[model samples]
Every structure is written in structure tokens, then in C-alpha cells.
Target: MSGQAAIVAHAQHWSGTPYHHRASLRGAGADCLGLIRGIWRAQCGAEPEPLPDYSPSWAEAGRDEALWQALMRHMTPAFVPADGQVLLFRLQSRALAKHLGIQCASGAQFIHACPRAGVVQAPLSAPWARRIVARFTFPAVFDRME
Candidate 1:
């Protein structure tokens, strides 16, 4: 399998996991970031670094692009989104980019962990398009995996 194929497969495996703050385990529970973390572990070996504990209001209070910065450090920025890329979302224009999801099916859809709905593959609709702040793909090392 190609790296993008691996990512999509890994994400789909956790489709029914319940949403739990700061959790990363598949099926048991996971938040959006946790879902990404789980995929990273499966595809890239170990995580590059440890993650700090964060509260739901961390973004609103810090008022900084901390998450985006973190992602940039690990992934390559993508000018054109493609399948298997990670997407960062800002709930509102002024809010920090606090949400994450994996692009699927050549960017027509994305899979994300919704608060009440668990992990779901939803269309990349107009409303979601407006909130996208950045797009990135995993490091090249992952791209070569079969």
C-alpha cells in the first residue's frame, strides 16, 4: 500500500471510536488530535515528541497558533491539498485553529472525530472550506511505505 493508502486505512479503522478529551486509544476513546496521533504511531513509528496536556479552552485562552506551529514542525506544508493530507480548521475566523481531520478521496471528503458523532467521513462542504487554515502532509519518510 502507498503511504496515502495506509493513512486512509488507518483512519478508517478508528471510525467508531467514541470522543474523549485527550484520549488516543482506538475504539476505547479519542479526540481529534488523538486520532491523528494514533495514525502517526501506526504509520511513522514513534511520535517525534511528547504532547502537553491541553484543555478545551487552551486555544481560546492562549490566542496563539500553537497547534499549527506544532504541525508545521512535523509535517510538510501542502499548497494543494491531496488525499491523506492533514487539515487544520479554525472554528471561527478569530479563533485559533483547534480542529483537525484527514483528507480523503482526493480532497472531496475528510474524516474527523466529531464530538457526539465519533469519527466520521464527511464531505468537504463550503462551510468547512471557509474554516480551513492550513493543509499538510506527513513527512516524506512515510510516503515511501508499502
Candidate 2:
């Protein structure tokens, strides 16, 4: 019931979900947030709150720490690790962090929904590594359930 094991289970639940902007439906369409939300329900049994609709530019709005603040209120933060865990990244140094993905496989790779890849594993190379800003663990209650 470690973060890695739970994340692997969550990642499996997202397999084959097609990419779709602002969508979150398993095996049909889901963007990155959608995938995370779906898995959150699978493991936690309920979403803590509703997510407001957002435009990509929401990250650039003057006070853009909205998403990070949301995470802070809900998910438990995890130590940074190469193994599977929830990850948040700052798209720009001066901007509020807005992207998310799951660390995968010994921290060598991650699975994220991207424009080019719906959900594919990629090496945690320098560029990707540089963007990472925070790590979070799923609720400990979920770990106990596992």
C-alpha cells in the first residue's frame, strides 16, 4: 500500500483512455486531470469536491496558484521519489504550477497525458525533471484499503 503500488494501480485504471481536452471518462476520453480525477474516485471512493472548469490560461491568471492550493487542501504531500507518485509541475518559474502526472517505475519514467501522447511512459530526462515542482501521495486511507 505504498505510494508506488497505489499509483501503479491507478495508472492501470487509466490504460486505454483516449485523449480529450477537458474530458475524464475511462476508455473513452480524458485529459490528464480527468485521468487523475477518475483514479481518485477509484481509490478514494469519492471526489473531495468539484473541479471548476478551466482554460489552459487559468494557470497564467495573475494569482494562479489555484490548482496547487487545491492539492494542498486535499491530497497528502509525498517526498520526491523516482517511484510512482502524484506529481505537479510548474510550467514556468514565475507562474503557478499547473500540470500533473504520475511518476512510474523506479522514477526512471512517468505516465502523463500530453498532446502528442495520450498516456505513454517516457524517461524522466533532464527537461522533464527540471519542470517537476512537487510530489503528493494518495490518501493514507487508500493505502489501508489496499
Best prediction by lDDT: 1
lDDT (Cα, tens digit) per residue for candidate 1, span 93-126: 6667889999997888998887888888899998
Worst 10 residues of 1 by lDDT: 137-146
Candidate 1 TM-score to native: 0.91
Kindly list the per-residue Cα lDDT of model 2 for residues 12-128, writing each as its tens digit.
667667778788777788777777777777777778988886765424645757778888888878775846577888777677677788888778888777655676667888888
Tell me the spans in candidate 1 whose CA falls farther than 4 Å from its real position: 57-61, 141-146
In model 2, the runs with Cα more than 4 Å from the true position are 1-3, 57-61, 141-146
How do the predictions measure up, each by TM-score? 0.91, 0.85
